[model samples]
Target: MTLYGLVSSFYNQKAAVHAALRDNIDTRTALEELRVLVSQSNAYIAGRKNAKLAPNRMLLQSIALYLTDLLKTFGAIEGAEPIGFPVGTNGQNVDLESTVMPYLKVLSDFREGVRKIAREQKVTEVLSLCDMVRDETLPELGVRLEDHEGLPTVVKLVDRETLLKEKEEKKKMAKLAKMKIPPSEIFRSETDKYSTFDETGFPTHDADGKEISKGQTKKLRKLYEAQEKLYKEYLDSMQNGS
Candidate 1:
């Protein structure tokens, strides 16, 4: 079943947490927090922004989330409470290749480790370590992890919309590519002829019948040249990528 389905049926975190622990041996508050953080951060990282989110932030969050889930599934966390958690005596196999399933292993490992530790429970310290791991490892993994299909439907929809918009833009550009515009000087000459029309009774010229200044003409020519260069470069890039 989908996570949303399970979440709705369960009606609360407690029920969902219970089910997550159902197949496992043990659970921990730290582990739960870490998992929840991973889930939340993944959504945040997946969200659209005016500017892209930093690559490091996205990678680190995915890795941390993946690791936490993997440990839990592996039954590795030590010093874990038995009441709310499930122990894995059946030795259920974990699939690391499965996009979302691999994270359970991270949770399992953490649980087993906590169980072995002789020290008392330290939620803050453990969470701090999780945060540190996330921060330290994000940069290294950000370059490697590709965005996957398990994202929210909204994200997927946005991606499709963006692609369609690009197609429309390309079509518009192609249409414009065939059109020819009169030279600026020709356009200005026509405008100047009409500038002295009988209706206004005021001279449109600033000082004389000058159409436009040399500097303005030069600036416009530079702008047009830059745009042409940019369009040529874009076409070359498309060819190369193809």
Candidate 2:
């Protein structure tokens, strides 16, 4: 299993033991499972280190050593006496659950620390990939790679012509944004070319979510007439570039 998967198994086993304690159930089975998972994680990291695996070997080893140190502090599992818990005020057994919770919390914090490191590693790798493409590949190919459908894992190449057209479209939108008109009005202007609106300038749609047409546009009430007026205005604006 991957280091991440190994770590998750250890954590899950620990949680199972905690839950067993909370429910006052027999914790023998859960404790056994926790020990087994921890042993497996240790073996996995040790084997990788011994063979000198190149990919993040130090990270795995460090995590394994850290876990070992924490478990040492843990003192022992259920089978051993005094499993890292202080006794009661009268020297009686204290709340085992409360006593043990702090150690588990430290383990949880360590897991989060590992997760933060993993995230940073991913971001660095992505930035390196971007730098490679931008500095080494873009000038050679004279084209840029864009992610397909907002998916970074899937990319499509964009030629100069397509890039220029996209830039021009962006410029047009920027100019439109600067115009002295409400955003709703600007959007309505674009829709007027393709849609039919009523006297209130609302789209000619009914409660059924379909366009409603009483009859031929000219023969109907102000609704159809308004649509015609909007269409004419749209055509004029397009021709005039207004």
Candidate 3:
């Protein structure tokens, strides 16, 4: 079976065991089912000689270790002693408390060992596989995975702040491209162009190089007044923090 299929089967078995425990029903059937699944997973791993199957092997091993611990816990709850053996032996009297304490300690130690192995091997491989699958199926979702030293690979959220900044910059550039120049600047530019010469392309002044026509002088004055008025308004807007 596929790796995903195996993983899914493992979870289903685990949930069955939990349900049985929660309902105070017969857990023996659920436990047996879990054991069978674990064995099948291990058998599949054992047949694979490829290095690519290393993660799958680790996953199965972790599941087997966890199932073993779970079985031990159930045994401890139902047995006369935690070890599932009679209290007093053939030759010597076994202290009930002492026997139970050692069983508890062994159970605890085994559980801790399983946790360490799962963290180092099974969990990391699972996370890496999840990231790979996500990348293949949902690349447009902007989700990402990152690896860390001495830690599992983690899912990274989309960078909304950077995306927002890029969007805003595009909008600002578009607005600036179509923006109208202020009236004050337009007026000044027009005035400079007209002052260069008369409409006929001749110098405004004659041989005397004094004043030109009064009409021309009046037009120039009106142009200067209009420019000054707009310039003052622009300065006022700036001062007001517009």
Candidate 4:
């Protein structure tokens, strides 16, 4: 195939990977998707004789997250996987290629790495490191790993609704995690635009940042106000241990 054709094919495979990871339907499928992604990348990298690539540049939070009993049971952890990414002491951000799973944290990290590589047009270096991680990982899978299916999953795959709810919960937790724990420091609410009309009653902008009819502006503003009130109630309920 021509170099253009080869590169295009490689990226299409990576897109498939992003889709699979974003949905995170099941662990089995995610692994299979990553394996397929890595294979195409291998071919593309082999053809890149013009660039010198460092296969070890990609970093994972832990080898055990892939090759050991962590994914098997994730012992000691109850609901979520670990939250941090791997980075070099030199302060360079590392890739999450070894985090090949359907869990939220792993899936999100892996997806972001793919996005960054595609964004920077630096696929040659990153994809090569992913294949190296795959090489190190597959040996530990042994007979459980299959050619057509993928690794045997150790945990139940939550349904789409549950998964989405969990994703939202993860996001909420991330936002809340930034704040100092309760009662440590006073929290100051950020200013928010309530409507197209600012406090001065001047025609301003809506959420879409466009000027609209007064009627439509009031409608959207009321809707958003109700949402904020309901969300505040939800947070209050959680604080009260409801």
lDDT of 2 by residue, 1-242 (tens): 56677667767766776676567565566557656776776677555545555334554455445444445544542222223333355646564445544654454345444545756776656556554554345435334443222222212234556655665687677654444343234325645232655554545554444665656333434543544565566567778997
Per-prediction CA RMSD (Å)? 19.7, 24.5, 28.5, 21.2
- The ten-residue window of minimal lDDT in model 4 covers 143-152
Give the total clashing residue pairs for model 1. 45
Across 79-193, the per-residue lDDT of candidate 3 in tens digits comes to 3332223345675546454534455445434544554676677676655544444443323433333333433333433444554455568667654442334433433344433
Q: Give the alpha carbon lDDT tens digit for every residue of 58-144 in model 4.
A: 222222243222233423323233432332435554433224344533533564467457548956667565443333333333211
lDDT tens string, model 1, 102-127?
45345434533553352356555675
Q: Pick the TM-score winner.
A: 3
Candidate 2 vs 4: which has more lDDT = 2
Candidate 2 lDDT at 7 equals 67
Ranking by TM-score: 3, 1, 2, 4
lDDT of each: 0.43, 0.51, 0.54, 0.44
lDDT at 146 for candidate 1?
28
In model 2, the worst 10-residue window by lDDT is 147-156
User: Where in model 1 is the C-alpha error above 4 Å?
Assistant: 1-13, 26-211
Model 4 TM: 0.23
Those runs of model 3 whose alpha carbons end farther than 4 Å from true positions after fitting are: 50-55, 76-242
Instruction: Estimate TM-scores for all models.
Output: 0.25, 0.24, 0.28, 0.23
Candidate number that wins on TM-score, 1 or 2: 1
